[model samples]
Target: MNELLSTEEKRAVIELLYQLADDDFIISYRGSEWLGLAPHIEEDVAFSSISQDTMGHAAMYYQLLEELGEKDRDYLSHARKSNERKNAVLLELVNGEGHYLHEPRYDWAFTVVRHYYYSQAKKVKIESLKQSSYPPLAAAAVKISMELHYHLMHWTVWFTQLLNAGGEAKKRMLKAIAKVEAEFEDVLSLGPLSKEIVKAQLIEEESRLLLSFHANINAVFNDLSIPYKGEFTSLSGRGRFGEHTEDLSEALNTLGEVYHSDPGAVW
Candidate 1:
């Protein structure tokens, strides 16, 4: 059985949980938008599975929050405003300019790069969380880690193949890498509560997490003979602090359409 957490520790834990849950929820929503619009039918199915897995992870985090006396999972997910969300801006950005239902100009290279980078970061974070001082969280980390191997392999294959194919594919992949790198710090960061979370022994320090993430990605680039300087910047505002773009506003409106209609209704 898990021990009761101190007030400060509980706050830190809740913050971290929100960050994990929101990030996965937003990204999975974006992935779901690509359901029937993927480049090919076979890939469409595989990608759907990944999206489902990601959303499942988000649900797990939200459930944890519910156990801690937060609102129910569905309300926490659908009722929260964009500014209230803790997801990184990278995940909230639209797949492209056009709507997902019509003429959706989704970028395959961006999808591959973003997924590969986020997956690596998540793996590092989960590994650290396996040693979390909170027993329930550490247990949850172990369960989540079981599913990550497949997620990592799936994205890594796409990342490597596209980078190796050369021609337009390679060019687009490189461009995507640059774009993702520019805004990836937000994804890797644990935000303003990082010090508290680390102090509570909930996870490792941000510096250590970044080191592991960079090392893993660097190894992949080296194997593929691609030049990687390994710089990550958060050009967009920090989502952890409740700052977000219009993209998140639009996403929340669309995703919450049903829930907002009747929040009190049991599903």
Candidate 2:
């Protein structure tokens, strides 16, 4: 009985849902690349678990879109071109040089920093969405929030351990942090429908969410006796506005390999 939304409200909701679903979809793919390749077996399992949970969250959002009379969840998740996607620019970047199946030289420090920053931001967004004007979205947020506790903890543990380890670990982490933060503005963005999304109360304003994220991460940094400028730049184009790097195109090509071969068994 939650079908009292106007056309505009529904459009905004759909767009926001696409952003949510697309962000998780791309990053979970990135996370999956680390399978069997994490620093150790235990971490291999843990990271795999997190990636699975994240993909499930993405499915939930796409299913919500389906309920709103959109395309099938399969097509939504698998068939969209990169520019049609609404994910943040940061999530679409490759893991590192070389293919995973080949001589993969992935950067663990970058992985830790990227996931840590993303986890914190996701936590903030989900908490806000729990109060979303759209009931289905709010409920989805509630369910997703339960699992995010572990997600945040896992990434935070890695971030903290690397920073405290000092020397090379710390240096690499600092570099990763800078790289991740440089593109974080788009991650926090609500896409081209920001005002409309905020107008519909699908989530809180980006400014407020940004403050919460800064405070949360700054406190974590302070605990480690590290200085955080909390600064971000628009050095990259807005993925939300259908702008993206070739990295996303490459990712889509790999991800859609099976789907293109046979959409029926895209799993």
Candidate 3:
């Protein structure tokens, strides 16, 4: 399959794979920070499972790239420089202030909002990728959609209850929503290779995906009495374009320290 693609076509596929792989990799690390610190024990377990599943999804994408003659999955995922990642700027932000193992001031509302919003966006892309011209990607999308059903449901429960809970919960959710929206545009973007990606039918174009995304989310917002603005932007630099925040670099250091310490040791 790797040998079959034209130069531009293969580049587009590699870029798309990197974007998908990096998004899951970074966000899963963010999710892992919540371990044992969730609002309750049940949620603690659930969040960990979801993060594990997401990281597995990231591994699949990375494997696909490896088959395309890129580096091994571990090197692609654990050793790639932060600027080489193609994840959305939104997914890379720290989960609040302070260290997770120390006097962590992590915000539950922000965690809930970011994961829920990101899950929705991921679902939208996965649905389109089900029909991706690339057979392996489409197959992976089908397999991923199975797990996403439960992932979305888990987050949906939190997203709805917290937003409509009233008082501080509502206020916190709203603030989190605004902060997430500021960087959500980068999530929806397909990056500089989008034209070639779309041209090769790797997945639907970004506008089409964005339109479907809005429709899917607006229904929930309406039920909760929140007005739908549909406005999103990249306040941070675009991650898909090799631009990122120090947040990503910091995250890489923490998450990859084990692999870095002994690159030959198997996880």
Candidate 4:
């Protein structure tokens, strides 16, 4: 696989890999913060499993980058600064405001909406990647897609149930959905390298993936008698362009605490 890739092709592949890895890594860290704070004991355990799977997916993408001659997976995941990261800004935002532990006011509605929207986008991207011209990426996409079914199901159930619950739950869910939609375009974008990524046949075009994502989500919304306005915006700076918020920096510090303490230590 290494021998087959030209310099330009390799660069594009590496860029896409970083975007994938960083997105998963940051979101999974956010998920981890919710570990024991989930609505119930059963959900706490379930959410942890999902978070672990997400981080595992990030590790897989990081390994692929390592194979392409990038920095070691640990360094890529831990040592990079927030501005050097490629995760979507939406993934990096704080759950609410206060710390996940202690008198926190984390938004369950936001979590449900964000997770549902993200999982849908991820499924669309993974489906397109399964047919990627890069055999290694296609293979990795196939592996990632296997776990995404459960991830999608879990979030979809929560999304619909919460919205259908009515009263404050429904209102909060709608508000959260609006917030998520405001910056969702960044999640659909392949960054500034979108042209090259698509030209190199690394993945499907952004428009195609976005269309599929909208269709998938709208179907769910329709089922629940919710309005399905296929509108998306990216008011936040693009993450693929290495633009991020302080949230990412704070998350990185927390997530990399142990690694920073002993970079040479073997787990």
Best by lDDT: 3
Question: How many backbone clashes does every candidate have?
Answer: 0, 0, 0, 0
| Candidate 3: residue pairs that collide | none
Error of 3 at 180 (Å): 0.4
TM-score of each: 0.97, 0.97, 0.98, 0.97
Colliding residue pairs in candidate 4: none
Q: Output the TM-score of candidate 2.
A: 0.97
Error of 3 at 76 (Å): 0.8
- Alpha-carbon local distance difference test for all models: 0.91, 0.92, 0.94, 0.91
Q: Point out the higher-scoring one by TM-score: 1 or 3.
A: 3
Error of 1 at 156 (Å): 0.5
Q: Provide the global lDDT of candidate 1 against the true structure.
A: 0.91
- Candidate 2, residue 223: the lDDT equals 98
Cα lDDT of candidate 3 equals 0.94
Candidate 1: list runs displaced more than 4 Å: 1-3
lDDT, model 3, position 237 = 86
The RMSD (Cα, Å) of candidate 1 is: 1.1
Across 1-267, the per-residue lDDT of candidate 2 in tens digits comes to 337998889899999999999999999999999898899999999999999999999999999999999999989998899789999988888899878799999999999998999999999999999999998999999999999999999999999999999999999999999999899899999988899999999899999999999999999999999999999864667888988999899889898888889887736
What local lDDT does model 1 show for residue 74? Answer: 95
Top TM-score prediction, candidate number: 3
